[model samples]
Structures are given as structure tokens and as C-alpha cells.
Target: MPDLPSGAVTFLFTDIEGSTRLVKQLRDRYAEVLAEHQRLLRAAFAAHGGHEVDTQGDSFFVAFASARDALLAAVEGQVALLSHPWPEGVQIKVRMGLHTGQAVATGGRYTGLAVHRAARIGAAGHGGQILVSQAAQTLLEDEEEDLHVFLRDLGEQRLKDLDRPVRL
Candidate 1:
């Protein structure tokens, strides 16, 4: 296992939307598609210095030490997924969410509201969309224009079980 991120960390969570439908449609071929999807996403995330924290079914939970790296990994992962040619021309859309906050790392797992908030943020997004919390966005404010990405104001979104709405 790789070293996990600690303290102030930016997390990237991703889930394949309508995955059960995909499984029904693809059947046995679904495994191949899933493997390729994971490969692409893992490659993209690793390239941006992301550590694979966990994978639950068709969802991935990754951690990054840098806020910019987390966002960049999300973009790269999305682009890779979009560009991949799936078996039988099937399209796989994954939703991602990013958040930056302090968390406690224990026994190779993270425990804190920040972790829950990050998961909720990812759960609230639609496929192909990368939703970023205001905290993560703020951390990227000092980034260079060379990053070549736009952070559109998406207003505030209320995540599941969260007390307050998070600006995206």
C-alpha cells in the first residue's frame, strides 16, 4: 500500500453513474470495461501524485497532498474516460468531487467530517461532472494560468446529510 495523505489534504472521490444499468447492458463485457476504466482513472490520478485511498465497487476514493493536483487529476481522469473506446461502444460516465480539509489518519483510513463531506460532495454530482468545494477552489486561487482550466461558479449545493450547503 502507498502512503496516505495527512493533515491538510485534498480528496477526489469518483463514482460511475448508472453503473447497475451498465452492468445489465454490458453483461460479461462489463468487467472488461470496468477494468479499463479503473486503469485509465488510476493512471490519471497517479500522474498527478494522487494516492489511491480506497475503491468500493465502481467508486474510487483518492487523496492528494496538493489541491491543484487533486483538481488536475480529476480533469485528466474525466478526459481519459471520455476518450476511451469501450467494448460495444458503451459509454461510461463517472462523477467526481473534490474537497480540501484537515482530517485524522488512523490505521490507513481517514476519520473526520472532512472525509464525510468529501464523500457527500462526490455523491451529489452527476456523471461526467467534476464538482469542487469552495474550500478546494480557494486553495487553487493562487495557481498559475498554465493549469488551463476554468473554475465556474456553480453557486451552492446542499449535499446529503450535511448541515450547510457547499459552494461549488
Candidate 2:
């Protein structure tokens, strides 16, 4: 198993939008599409030191040592997915969400509120959209690295099952 990050970690959660519809539409080819999607995402994530925490169906939960790495991985993954040629001119759009906070990693899984927050943030976004929680954004803003990444204030909003509202 890969070494999952412990303590303060940036979590990135992603999933394909309308995957059921895509599966129905693509049938046998859907498996191939999913495989390619995973490949592209894994490559991008690994390139930026992202640890693959978990993946189920068309969703991925990855951890990064830094918020910047997580954001960079998301951007690279999105670009790769968009540019890839699918078998039937099909577009596979993935939604990504990032959050940075304290967490505990044990037995190849993470246990903490931050993990849930990250998953909820990702669930709130549309396919092809990358959402960042305020926690992650704050860390990113403090970094000196010029990622050339810009974020528009999505305004604070309450996410499902989350006690406090998050700024997207």
C-alpha cells in the first residue's frame, strides 16, 4: 500500500458526473473509458505527489502533502481529461473538490472531519468544475509559488451534513 499522508493533509475528491448515464450510453466501451479516466487522473495526481487514498466506481479520493500540489493535480487532471480522445466522441467530465485540514491516516484510510468536508465539497460541484474549500484556499493564497491559478469567490454556502458553511 502507498504511504498515506498523516496530520495536516490536503484532500482531493473527484468523480465523473452522470456516470450511470455514461455507462448506459457506452455499455461495453464504458469500462475502457473508465480505465482511461483513472489513468489520466492517477498520472496527474502522482506527478504532483498525490497519494491515492481510495477509489470506487468513478470516484477518487486522493491526499496531497500540500494544498498547492492538490490544486495543481486537479488542474492537470482536468486538462488531461479534456484533451484526451475518447472512443466515441464522448466527453468525460470530472468534478474535483479540495480541502486542507488535520487528519489521521491509519490502515490505508483517513479518519477525520476534513475528509468528509472534502468529499462534500466535491459533491457540490458540477462536472468539469473544480471547487476549493476556504481552508485549502487560505493555504494556497499563502504560497509563493506562481501556479497562475485564479479563484473566483463562490461565496459562503452550507454543504450537506456540514455544520459550518464553507467558502467555495
Candidate 3:
């Protein structure tokens, strides 16, 4: 992986909700559903110009050139999942977090406080919720209303492995 050029970039982290329980309950059936979910998420990310950087189980890490694109992708992903039917007793919801900041990309991987912050924010969000950092929020403030998405400020939250609280 090559190093990412120095500049501001937006990071988006998403994870499926209740995945552990679903997998435990559905067994082989859960695997099939998860595969379909990944396909849908991948398409949504690509459609919004998001770069799929990494995937760990049901969690996806993506990078975008702009905050707007990240937000749109998150919303679109949720909408797409909502429209799909799931196996009985299986509910698929996604939690997403977005942050904008400078990061170092190397070996086709991204690292830095930005990525950590984004992950923290994602953890703070409830299933089916999209949480954006203050920087991301500022970028989307003007357009959020027009986009018909409601963004509730979550103030500051202390995240694991981070020194300071991240605003979402």
C-alpha cells in the first residue's frame, strides 16, 4: 500500500448491529444474510464515491474525498437496508461514524487520530444511526436539512484508546 498524500480526508466506519446475536441464532443462515449485506454496503459506498479500505467481519472502513459524500453514503446505506427483507428474527441495522482530518496512508492502509476518532464516534452511535464529528457536522450543516436527515449533536464522548473526547 502506498502512503496517502498529506491532506484532509473524511473517514467513515460502519458496523452491523446485533450481528453477534444474529449469527448465533441463524448459524449458516446468518452467513448468507451477512454476505448479502456486504454486497449492498459495497455498492452503496461505490455509488457515493467512497473508497472501501478495509472490512473486518461485519464492520467496514471507508474513506471519502468529501464529507458530503460520506454522509450521503451512510444515509443511502441505511435506506437500502431498510428496504431489504431479512431472515426471521434477524434485524439488520448499521451504525456509522464520520470524521474529517489529516491522515497518513501507507501500504494501502490509513492511520492517525482521524481514523481512531471515527471509530470512536461509530461506537457511540446506536444501531441505524449516523454520527458525524464536529468537523463533518460543520461541513454538512447547511445541507443536512435539505437532505432530509436529522443530525442530533451528541456533544463530547470519551473513547477507548483516545486521550480526549470526540464531538459527534
Best by lDDT: 2
- Candidate 1 at residue 155, lDDT? 97
Candidates by lDDT, descending order: 2, 1, 3
Q: Write the per-residue lDDT of candidate 1 for residues 8-125, one digit (tens) a residue.
A: 9999999999999999999988898898999999999989999888998899999999899999999999999998877665889999999999998877888899999999999989
TM-score versus the correct structure, for each prediction: 0.96, 0.96, 0.93
lDDT of 3 by residue, 1-168 (tens): 323334688899999888888888888898899898899988898898888888999999999888888899899998888888887667898998999989988778888888888888887778889989999999888998888888888788888888888787
The whole-model C-alpha lDDT of candidate 2 against the native structure comes to 0.93
Residue pairs clashing in model 3 are: 1-107, 1-108, 4-105
Task: Score residue 52 of candidate 3 by CA lDDT.
Answer: 84
In model 1, which runs have C-alpha deviations exceeding 4 angstroms? none
Deviation from native of the Cα of residue 63 in model 1, angstroms: 0.6
Which regions of candidate 3 are displaced past 4 Å? 1-6
Instruction: Give lDDT: candidate 1, residue 121.
Output: 91
